[model samples]
Target: MVSLLKNRVNIASGTPSRIKKLIDIEALVLSRLAVILLDIHPDVKGYSLFTLPQVRDEFWDLYKNYFHQRLLEGDLRICLYGPLPSGNEFKGKKST
Candidate 1:
């Protein structure tokens, strides 16, 4: 479940606009997971099942923090395998 959530987050980060536009999908998945988790572990908190707004906001915060760190370190390109956004293009150099 953690892995699946992580994958979804990664994908959302890549194309935030697209994710935002199709937020129903994200909400559905999250809600379903939340229901299952809650059913199995009643003691657990429901914060993990944040609404679409929460997920979107939280994801951007995390993404910004990560991007800031890479930018400060002068890393030219950030290549996330999933939904995370690609980094700024560095002129006159190949990322590879």
Candidate 2:
């Protein structure tokens, strides 16, 4: 996913895709953690992500560090929403 972020730092250079990953990508670190701990992507309970009583409690710090690093290095964009307003025209999977 780091590669995805690297390739999308610029909004003007991108094309529309099947996945709408802007807002949800904000909490991407949690999804990474969830995948590590539960083999899932949902947070389960991200309310206290910073003060978790579990082994993955450090994940929040890691996420924050990576985010800041990306910002400082200009590897990610502050305007992650890009040229669109976002989520208003979502093309999510059909309800089955």
Candidate 3:
């Protein structure tokens, strides 16, 4: 997701903070989930498939909390699209 981060960094360049903490947190969570899934279930594919929505929700919450204001439509759209496996739609899914 380097490209996503690059785009975000470029967009947020004019903002006060040099680093995007929310983006970083989202990336870290995704990476850690990926590594764990891969290691524990080497034969299992599409494991990363399940965590996408959680990641999106987490990012959204972070953005809302950190910014303490509603994101513009365009910014919200960008944040939504940056995460992988588009249209995560986790509603009604069972949790372990």
Could you say which candidate leads in TM-score?
Answer: 3
Each model's lDDT comes to 0.36, 0.33, 0.35
lDDT per residue, candidate 2, 1-96, as tens digits? 888777533222211111123324652332222111111222446322222334234444443644456645555443322233233322342322
Rank all candidate structures by their lDDT, best first, as comma-separated numbers: 1, 3, 2
Off by over 4 Å in 1: 1-51, 72-96
Q: Evaluate residue 85 in candidate 2 and report its C-alpha lDDT on the 0 to 100 scale.
A: 27
TM-scores for every candidate against the unseen true structure:
0.22, 0.22, 0.27
lDDT of 2 at 75: 54
What TM-score, to 2 decimals, does candidate 1 have? 0.22
Error of 3 at 70 (Å): 5.2
Best by lDDT: 1
Score candidate 2 by TM-score against the native. Answer: 0.22
Which candidate do you rate higher for lDDT, 1 or 3?
1
TM-score of 3: 0.27
- The lDDT, on a scale of 0 to 1, for candidate 2 is 0.33
